[model samples]
Target: MQFADAKERVLSLHQQLQEHNTRYYVLDDPIISDAEYDRLMQELIQLETSFPELQTADSPTQRVGAEPLPFFEKVEHTSRMLSLSNAFNREDLMEFDQRIKKATGLDQITYVCELKIDGLAVSIRYQDGIYSLGATRGDGQIGENITQNVKTIRSLPLKLATPINLEVRGEAYLPKKEFERINKQRADNGEPLFANPRNAAAGSLRQLDPKLAAQRALDLFIYGMDGSSEVYTTHQETFRAIKKLGLKVNPEWKVATSIDEVWEYIEHWQLERSKLGYEIDGIVIKVDDYALRTKLGFTAKSPRWAIAYKFPAEEAISILEDIELRVGRTGVITPTAILKPVVLAGTTVKRASLHNEDIIREKGLLLGDHVVVKKAGDIIPEVVSVITKERTGEEVAFHMPTHCPECNSELVRLEGEVALRCINPACAAQIREGIIHFVSRGAMNIERLGEKVVILLYEHKLVSSVADLYYLQKEDLLALPRMGEKSVDNILSSIEKSKGNSLERLLFGLGIRFVGSKGAKMIAEHFGTMDAIVHASEEDLLAVEEVGPKMATSIVTYFKKPEVKELLSRLQGANVNMTYKGPKIVHANDSDHRFAGKVFVITGTLESMSRQEAAEKLEQLGAKVSNSVSKKTDFLLAGEKAGSKLKKAQELGVTILDETAFLAEIER
Candidate 1:
């Protein structure tokens, strides 16, 4: 299409999308289906692709930036984002009303009561009604610039209705459903879970990559605008104005004419919070009129016009029903506490990890004892402590079992380790765990193939080892309970795709004793091929920076096994990638090499090359490229959007160089 025609289509699409976004996010009603909205966005993307000149910052398709930032730069707020004082009970709210009435000499002062969303506080600025900058509230005065990250929030408008300059404050939150989804994914990938929705939202916004932030499904609720009465007199009127300007405001906000009304609003929300899609910790009460807020100005850290009423802490007590022992992928025996169901943190608490035998002893845990329970990070169930006074004489003292529950082998406590391990190599439990680890996120990253599926495959006598996964057929998966045509296809596709992963992933997935992901990467890079690593002597293995004597011995011993040799042969036959794709870093002590043994750190977007490519280039030339900058860093390669790391480098007096300088030095 011609540029003029494309531009017209793009403008039309933008208007349609803006209306749909407002309808869905602000009004909680969507006129179009998600598929239909995606089709429109796809059309806009195509038009913009053909006519790059028509693409603007405010375009809906431009939500996620093309590149990630190195670090967040500091931004100054036009006005301080003051916090609110706390109100614990009805007496506190009544006291606040009396104090304000006595000071202002007014009767029945009207207030705006809003739910206090448990999220990150952010300031968004607009220039001529177009979104310009977004920032986190750091110490009220200065904040980190998160403009790119915040732009990914779908509910936030890129351009206001009227072309007028304004700034608004909102709480950026991860919805309860999204939080649960993220935690589930993290659990599957063997990553730590965020304690709650608040932490999840904060972590998402702070992500360096705009693409990552966009995937988090973050939402915002605009509470206030700086320099009140700029467009409206009352606080409630300000909400109306911003809504007209295409901003999202919390619909639950109510005008309270008296302290009784405020208390009633709080009481209603306190009971209704669990039913809502989002998380709220308290209620925010603000004086309704802008004039009244101005008269009752600022406190040192909080506003005299408003205060937050916190809810009771989320906790509960449950009875410890029983203890269950389980074996890990590495044959490490772990204990789990089975609890009588109790409601906490919007979910029922049933079980908590004991981690190992030592933790159970430390907590003085007993079967049938009443235990204080809470969700750790609001994701994992945890037994905080045993209520000694609530313990009955019928409660049984718990002890670690002497043997593996699956293999029936005698467990051993390895030297310098607290956990008991079942060392039997042919242990069925260990074999299943090894396969599970092979398909995990940091390894092959085979999606949909979870622990339960792996257990099913083993129990059904279909697969014996990790290599056997490659041989699974469509019929085999279709046989599993609840496995349908589409789900099985996806799992099979994921398994096939994992075959092309680089050598580091395979090495890590191999579950080599004493060798972690970093060590595996270094070893892979050093040898350049799986064959070389398997055949390498201890001395050759020791030459790698991350490999030590214990690690080298372990690697050598692992490869020497006949069964491992057979597994490798099968994997090779299956056509899995066996070679490192990056430039080899080990150079056998070429002292004349530039940057030999010198530490280097790369930051931001490099125009000439990707960060990983640059790291490989430096590593090949004998430099140790680190992720973080410190006093020991010999050089810092800075590119566009470099911020915190660059500042820290300067503070540490490390040698700082732009991309040009870095390229010149490395090339020479």
Candidate 2:
């Protein structure tokens, strides 16, 4: 076929497949059979393969097998992706209600309850109703741009029926069926499988090439808007507007008049969630009145007018078929409960964490006992309670071993801690886990080195300590399975590149006890370099803000280890960047007049500026840009239909401003 003719044919096939996908997957009303859709896709692939030069980035055949990128470029979000405060139990929900009432001075309030999807949060930008950009909520301030991949989602409207400029926030998720299918394919290909749908979604979205992201069969639901040419006063109205624009919105959302009704909505979904094809971790409850939402205000990270009511971990009765113990990287031995296969929270539960001896003793779990198992955060499985009433007298009581399962070293429980430690530095399990942690994304972010590669290196004895990784030769790596010359070269390059990462990343990579990313950054900032950090007294460490006595002791103890010192010396010899510089430090004190004392609550996506940039600008003008609407809020910066907060702000009679108005106010 001629190149132009093939291109035309491919475009037609793509449109047809998109329509079929929307009908089958999004609308749950298929007009065509799976076999027919497959045939159409196959034809498009054939045509694209024949005329490769004619294939466009948006073509359906380009979803997979794109060359890996060097790195993901940073995309600044027009609006900050604020997270919701969690309400663990009924009491917490009640407290949230009480706080809202006190702040808004209202006798009662309405709430909009929607399922909190256990997936990746994404923002899709549309210009004149045409899909423009899609980004992940990276650090709430910046995200990776993935517009071409997002366009492949058939449910997402590439071009809206109405010509409107807007930004919509939604959860990009892999359905259970799709996740299973992809994992099965990976297993067949001898590749590592994703642990869960959330991981799969995250991995797919972060693929630097849009073609790889497009092939993931990802789906989305529009839940919030940032800025829109059209106006929406309430959360419900916003949903309607999004639906009117031919975007997918969750049908399960409901408006509640009181907290009890909100609880009811949550309870109803807790039972119904399993029936749905997708995964939802909890229910998000938000104040319905935009004006009232403004009056209720926001905290630094989350909003006071909203809370996520997570369901208690989904539990299922399973027989304690066997008991096993595994030693962790920290030398702590964890008891695992091997169960008779039972489905829980949409996945099959085969094992649950016993945590430690205290938990086993507290629960009185025994072999052959029918026990209640659950997945904590829909990820880690744990035994919640034992159905002891059904336990047969023949069931045996299990005891934790006194020796490390991997190293056979004597386990010792510390003075105050419940966990028993193996203290054996050379334990195979500990070495493997430590190496994995050292290369983790939040740590050194070693590219082309996943957990599987780390384990392979450990098994082959190519790497024993974290320092050994830096010394590995391309030939040494090339000897491993699936490691060709090209792959080995890539891995070596990534390892070399990681050596220049900031000091904060190195500190976190060390896996120091009680030291997280934030704490590591603080320590790096205060100490300036690794040498200073190692030499600093515990008292000096403690003097740093947010670093308490426990953390101080941990830092001192971690550096005191001769092995750790050796690793640091090797890293230094390799010319690794060991000093902390700091983040892109932008000061908001640049200006101070127009926005003084004016509280602005920004919602939805902005066009030219990121949420952080806008917030910084507002702050520079002496304005307080809060996450939620509250009584102190003088203006509700409505982007698109700004959700329930917008409605609450309206009900409370707070002044509303679109992005243009907000920008104008800031300019003044």
Candidate 3:
């Protein structure tokens, strides 16, 4: 074929594939079957291969790049990505109204309320309608470039309806079904599981491999846009414009002219949030007028005109069936309450964390007793209190296990911590839990090798260590009960695939005491590879940002173990990749700010800024921001409608600051 003809055909293919992608991924509606789409993609790939000059970054085939990067490049945002302050109740919403009226000198204020999606905030830039850049909201001013990863989100438009420059911000989240499916897969693979949809979405977005991000089946909801070229009079108009541009936006938003209407919207969503496929922790209320938002201005962290009304913790009543002791990777014995099946929020609750013996005793939890259960942040289920008045004589008092449930080792409470721990490192339960953690979604994420399979493998002595997983044979897996050929093959394939995961996943999977996923990623990026990390001294680790003395000691101690050294060697021999593959955390020197070294709890509603904005300002000034008020809290920044947190702060003798005082202190 002539070169000219080939160029025309390639252009056509690119347009067709992009449109198909938009329909299938973004719209969740496809005109063609998967097979048909594959055929077209194959045709485009062939054409591109033959005419390499015609290839472009926007091509569908470019989703999975040739190699993962050493680290992400930092992209400074055109505008700061502000965080919202929160309101917990109706009173807080009314106070928000009062603040708006005071600021604008208007008796009544109109507010646009949208779902506060429980997901990662991201910004996507488009040039002349074509997608250009995508980034995370890293510290507001600067963010890590994730353009390739964002491209895989089908709901996001690669090209807009109009040829205009735009920067759209949205929440990238895993739908409830997808979150459950991914967690289930992780559980099956005997991997550490994602705590919730939000975490899963964040982890998926941070993946060095865009292909990995794509497989996560992520969705997006574009809420607002940033750009100087376009103007919209109101928030509702902007939403409509975003929709017209072929971007997905949540439909359940309302414009309330009065605080009562705002409360109405909040009340409706509190019940309806559970019904949505994705999680919404709260509703974001903003002044409907863009002019008003501009006039109200932004604080260091959030827009003063906007506030998120967070839903109260959801609670339900259930019967406690029994108390089960579960040993962790660290050999902590946790008493989990087995409950009669009950629905809490939108999910079924069969178990709730009893935490420890002290909590169980404090709440007088007894087996077969009726109890109140609640999900903290709508994720973790825990017993709130026991319904002792309703308890019959048949109910039995609960007891903590004297020995580890898995290893029969004596359990002891540590000097200061509330947990009862089994010090035996070689405890079978610890080993099992460790392996499960290693394979979790946030870790190596080996699919299909789940809890039952891992236990089965261990019982049969087919696999006992994380490294042993690489050495697994198909025939050995096939020997297990109900293990079919297909399942064995799938597990083998997943295990092989995990070998390509960057060091962070492996590091997190290792379950180093006191090291979390964020720390693992930071350490992995700072060190560059597993070898560098293994050889890193305490001083070297200490130099890394966010690494404390305890964490540094933990790393050094963990690596020095002969078993760990050998395990690393085995993983190396098995050809697992060990290098860091995401953006390195840049260590910027902290400037001395007034609130430095203080601890803050932001409660109620602030007039000057959103709760997040206030927290960010406090954090910027070197203050530690905590969710709950405690004895350690230096100050409770209270606003109107301050509830339990305020009361708790008062009881704890924590200092309280009004919004005016908070602003004054920060400014001073």
Report the lDDT of model 1 for residue 300. 59
lDDT of 3 by residue, 518-611 (tens): 5786688889989889899999999886699999999999999999999999999999999976543433245466566777898887776888
**For residue 453, what is the lDDT in candidate 2?**
94
Predictions ranked by TM-score, top down?
2, 3, 1
Q: Estimate the TM-score for candidate 3.
A: 0.57
Tell me the spans in candidate 2 whose CA falls farther than 4 Å from its real position. Answer: 1-73, 228-230, 314-316, 322-338, 341-352, 377-380, 399-668
User: Ranking under lDDT, best-scoring first?
Assistant: 1, 3, 2
Error of 2 at 48 (Å): 15
The sequence of per-residue lDDT tens digits that candidate 1 reaches over residues 489-553 is 99899989999988988999999988887688899987999999999999999998889999999
TM for every model, in the order presented, reads 0.53, 0.58, 0.57
Indicate the worst ten consecutive residues by lDDT in candidate 1: 643-652
Give the number of the best model, judged by lDDT.
1
Cα lDDT listed for each candidate: 0.85, 0.78, 0.82
What is candidate 1's CA lDDT for residue 349? 76
Candidate 2, 313-335: lDDT as tens digits: 66788999998887777888888
Model 3 lDDT on a 0 to 1 scale: 0.82
Residue 96, candidate 1: how far off, in angstroms? 1.1
